[model samples]
Target: MSQTGTIAKKDALAAHPPAPPWAELDASCQLPVLYFLLSGLAWLLVGTLLQFEAGIRLLCPDWCAVCPAMTYGRLVPAAENALVYGFASQMGLGIGLWLLVRLGRTPLVASGLIAAGNVLWNLALTVGILAILLGDGTGHAGLEMPAYSQWMLLAAYMFVGIWGVQTWAHHTSGPYYASQWFLLGAMFWFPWLLTTAQLVVVTFPGRGVLPAITGAWFAGGIQHLWLTPLALAAIYYFIPVITGRPLRNYHLAVVAFWSLALFGGWSGPARLIGGPVPAWIVSAGIVATVLLLIPVTIVALNTGPVLGSRLGQVCENQVLRFLAVAVFCFVLVSLGNALNALRFRAAVTHLSLNEWARGFAYFHGFVALTFLGAAYHVVPRLMRRDWPAPRLVSVHFWFTIVGLALVVIPAAVDGLRQGNELNDAAVPAVKIFDQLRSVFGWRVLGLALMSAGNLAFLTNFGWLLIRCWTPGIRSAVALFIDQSGKSVTAR
Candidate 1:
């Protein structure tokens, strides 16, 4: 070897040893993130199917294959299950593992159980989804998964959730960061929701309207307090780290977390406003939904200024680019939700396309897009590989953003149109069909692009995985890796 080459090697040895191989033992880093992304993808697909079927059922009369099981009515629940159970729950587990590994400053503690939980969670979701596909789906929306399945799911998540909470309890870092609140709270919130939802929706047979109300509460609870907090924690950790900014309003962030959790499980049945429920239950829902504004406002306000100066800087980094868009969408969806909570808005939108759009927007933008953005940061680090292309990342962002727009905007317009038509005594139900066709078409278009984007994301994921997993390939690649670069996927 040349003298200079020998000198370079000595300098390298003197500089620092390679990062530990914990990331490999703990591919659990990707689990929670993947769960959220895939679940979001499942929701996107289900949401698309819902929009398409609604339009086709209205326009095409002979579409009898559009039976209860296959129709938008059934597909909506299937999609929700796919997202909540299949994707989001898995993602949460991954997040917990990743966080535990990092905060513990070691390889994951109890990661094997966590890994087992991840597999079981996906398996339960697969079986449950197939059950839905086979038409065994319970007539309920979020509660379609059978009681046994729910219990199975509860067990699966419990395995990981315990470790996530313990990670925070054991965190040696100075003060628990904002991400800890999100990650740890999510760990606690979800099992409560899953157990609660199962009892109300399935276990307690013959409970009249109470089951429906309880189920709704459970669904809303998980959506708001559990998965969302997990996603938001990821957003807080990544945005500041990537942008090199501190969290704005640290005190407000903590207060909002508590208030939001308190108010979360109360808004769902409000979506069932006109149902034959007690006046008090509906009133409570209405009040809770409105009060959500406080937390939403606080969060949005906090993120707004923290991300303000960095908005320009956000683009300089690929990871923040996806986050910045999702963050903005988060603000929009929260405001839309606030409006929907208004009894007046709910009256017009409760069962309308706008409501569906709003639902998808919140679930997709907040959960799916945010997690996708995070994967861009977390995955590459774990894999110890450079990103394939910055342009591909940008494409992924637009695909998600534009797709979300098509889904939400048109549905909102169609929903308002349908509601206005319903409210008018003179208008026939037939005219509402005409309004739905054009808007539903938009929803389908959005999902198609979103799905394609996900495929692109999957390709990137495969590359990252291979680099981290295949020792032979990694040894040959001379991939640029620094202290920040760590891809631990290999088991």
Candidate 2:
């Protein structure tokens, strides 16, 4: 308690600073993350192909007219389901688990269980997509998988989810990191939302319009609780690391976290603005959605200055570039959602392509981009090799951004036009469909470009894997040369 004793304690602690949390982890701990990432990429490829097929069908209804399995109604939902469950969820789990271990200062226990769970998770998604194409879909938005398939997904999630919970439980340090909170919240919240949706709309079939209400709720929850947190966690971790600065106003992170958790779950109902649901439900949803801006703004403020300081790095570092764009998209989508929640805008955008546009913006533009950036960082660390080709990374980045802009802009513009036309009783439904032909054509083109970008990603990932297994191909360190003109290894 004396001044001399306090000074001595401080000096000792500073001199013997603790080791980095990640240093405790070994290669075995990385296996689960790699498995999840590889599986996610595979699903992403499948989802992109399905999206292209669905887009083409929209543009030319008769392209596969003879095959009921290839019908737009079937293909579109299957594509959406695959992207959500197969690609997004799988990548999220992998990235989240890895971050938790690093931040929590603990090694991941139950690696085998996590791997097995991921296998079941992918298998369930496979079965679910097949069932949708084969006409056994639940017909609920965000819950399109058959009941049997849903159960399989949930069972697999149990194993993986347990690993996250146990990892958090085993943390050996004080003052939890921001990434840890978001990762833990996402891991716990998703299964709860999924199970509740199933029970309400599947097991105990809602009456009349109840199914629609529940479906809207489920869809909203997926974005706000699951996808948003996963993306935010990645952003929080990368921003500080990439910028070489601790977060500003770190204490406010707790406030931001609680605000999102409390408000996000209820925010889904805003999409049901004019539905048969009670007026209060719609009002509650709108308020919650608008309130979400608090947390979004907090995050932006926290990372803005740090990221701004490193603007130059964005061009040089592939990971930083992807992350910068992802953060921008996150803010854009959040504000857009708040604007869309208004009664006037909701009336115009409701049941229109605008919803699809927004969904794609969040999933592909924000969440998927974040995952891709994280992969750029995590893959090199795991494989101990720098990316084989910087050109491939550039190709993937530019194509994805351009493709998303093409898709989102056209979809929103056309959706607003369609909504206005639909409101005009004088406009015939057939005329509306005819007017959308050009928009659908643009969408098809966008989807094609997006698929091409994904292919580049796959190719790069494949090369990295090959090099990881092959001996003496090239040391990741040798990929770069130091100022002295000698080969320098990347750390």
Candidate 3:
């Protein structure tokens, strides 16, 4: 109780104050991440425009038939290429870089190179999308971009991704985090996947049917090795942050990561089932796809409690809601994929809208939602401001969920119907076409809703950035409601 004893106690407490919950990432890294996100969102808008055109064409094939570039074949591919390469790839890289830097507790090295890489990456995508519209598409489902543009994209990706590698290598002395493992794994896998696909399918021109096999392989790698990991990394980080608890069964997360890495890319061969390729290839893909359930189950078990504990808070937190939906969708997609890889289902789903539905579930449903959630969390920290429009954010979230549901549900049903009709010799081709007209009409409605949601997001973000530039009036014009429903400002 003496003054000297009290001073000693105070000193002890000061010496080891608990660390802040979040990382103190360097300020300079914000620009590169922001640039990447902005570019990605811009492309998302462009892709949305293309989606409207493609969707309308589905409803009326001859609506724009006079223009070669507006043909369904070209427009659909163009939309896909824009969404995958432009929006998905860029946003994935941005979120990955941000997580890597934060978790590694290091400043981003060579950030200027990353900025340049981002610009070049966007440029390459632009050229590639233009090429597709001009009928220079490679005709590969995932690799529709021309060879020249792909090479440029690869080069640009290296410039940006190397910094992530360096950050991981220089991570602070401690046990590696689960998020870091996934981010680093994605950065490392992408280049190999891209290069392998390019050489086998485009640069070297594989033998008959080989190109198809290679394309399918590359597409699977992109989903499993690249996009899935990125999404997982975000989910892993966001869940703990939102719930104010560490991830339960932390050791299982490591197993999940390794399982995904080991078994993920091999599942690509599932697409080759019933193809010209050897029977062993198809068998390998089916086995790999089925085995994927291991990791999926592990992830579900690990995150389920964390999400369950916070169910009441999910509605209040935008980031938590998005992440919750994303994780659920991820599990569903994985299960669906495994089941569809079975011989019976694959035979029915092959060359049908069901395949497109599955792709949408992965890219739009899982990956995009996770990335948006991360952006919602990260942007405020980067800009030193809160999101200016909560209402708009809510609108975006609901619209996206509804739109995706519309697309996935209807397309899947139509695919099943078409597949059964194809298997039935009694069904006339004209009747089948007529049936699909209604399916495409539903897809067009979904696309319109999605486009509206994306535009709302874009406008909100644009205003946020503009407010950042004019700090003098930010307090007056850039208002955001706090959790208690009280207005606050960046100041």
Candidate 4:
């Protein structure tokens, strides 16, 4: 061909590159994945409302005092369970399954079983939340769900997990990505944590401080081992894809991964520092929590340069912005946890709302935000449609950033104040709690903003689904109308 002809061919190819071959894989799992995402978003809204209600009650004890179910004891636990299991875990599973199939270069297997398991899991959560509200909570911090509910969750997990493992096992030949490792770890780690909590703490009824120790361990594992890993899986997978570059320091990713798995579970006991648990256990936990910084720092180092290099791209792409913020939150939360675990700091902060602030930052700011980015990238591809409202995405992002700031910063500062006051013999507990009413007000405002963000997401997703399905609905209606018209003409 002549030079002009070749040049024109190159330009045409640049204008319309070959399409990615992801359509079939995405289609195969579309229904189940969409179900998980939608239900997860619904649960997030539910949990946020409950959180807002609980915050209000804290500010004014008489606000909901008439209803037993609205008591702080019941409402707080129910909210935590709903947010953790109903929203975070369920959403993480959906995202993880997609990553597992995509990264493995394989079609989804056992999708029917996976969907059934997903339904079962949600049903179990609903029952457990109701059980807590009705005063059937076991009173174990993380295992508040009753014994039967725990068993049901475990069974539901087996149906999902067995197939996940099988899918991973049968993955097509390729070098594994870092996301796969984290996804697989999460799939296995959650069951172990839940089973142990059920057996040792709930089902078997451990003696005295053993139950407390076990509960703390279980709670910690859920955050560190299960939720954080799932978040990281998305982070690792999406960062490079969005930036159109390989992750920097790729060699060290394995070290970071293993170190996290090693220390994440052990860090749980740090929460028990001032409790009646064994001093040795507490000391071990402190060490583990501090060591967690190694992996956290490694992650920052691995991803920071690439993100820094792509500052323009990061700004232009909404998903990249979410992952960037997630990384920052992950680093900040890790450092805060390490500092809080120290004996000197833990002495004052123990039993204060400082821990609450940290939990919120980690869960909402880090993990959930990461998933938000993932949803933006994945949902559009699955439906073969772009977001119906780009502006709603921006609205969600801003609301989350501002809302998280309002919630975390004020709560953390006030928690420290409460902790310091509690340590002073001269200060009365009543005065310290009385001062917290204002802090609770700020949290309520934050929760409202966050809930608005959730609503925006839900609305955007609903619109996208409707747009995608509208053609089919219209076609079916038109066919029926045509048949009726022909019959009338014959008559």
Per-prediction TM-score: 0.85, 0.90, 0.91, 0.94
Q: Write candidate 1's Cα lDDT for 1-491 as tens digits.
A: 25335423432343224533444534545554444444544544454454455445544646777466566555656767776666565655565556556544445556566667766776777777667767777776578877767788788877777866665576654577677777777888788877766766787744678777887787778778887787878876776666556778768888778777877768766766878889788878877777877777777776778678886777666677777777777778778877787777778878887777777877777777777777776655554455666567777778878887887887887788898788887998887766677775777677777767766676666665565467755543543444345554323
Give the alpha carbon lDDT tens digit for every residue of 161-198 in model 3: 88779878988747888889998899999999999999
In model 3, the Cα lDDT at residue 111 comes to 88
Clashes of each: 14, 1, 0, 0
- Clashes by residue pair, model 2: 477-489
What are the Cα lDDT values of the candidates? 0.68, 0.83, 0.83, 0.86
Per-residue accuracy of model 4 over 1-491 as CA lDDT, tens digit each: 25335423432332224423465777667766777788888899999889988888887888768899999889888998999988888888888888887777677788888888889989999999999999999988888999988799789888778988888887775688899999899999999999998999988977889998888788778988999899999999888776667888888999988988999888899999988989999898899999999889988998899899999988878788888999999999899999999999998887898988988999999999998889887788677677889899989998988989989999899999999999998999899988988788889999999999999999999998888788777766776877655322210
Q: What is the lDDT of residue 348 in candidate 3?
A: 85
**Model 3 root mean square deviation, Cα atoms:** 7.3
Best by lDDT: 4
Decoy 2 TM-score against native: 0.90
Compose the digit string of candidate 2's lDDT tens values, residues 374-444.
88877766665567887998998998899888888888889998988988889999998788878778777
- Alpha carbon lDDT at 4, candidate 2: 32
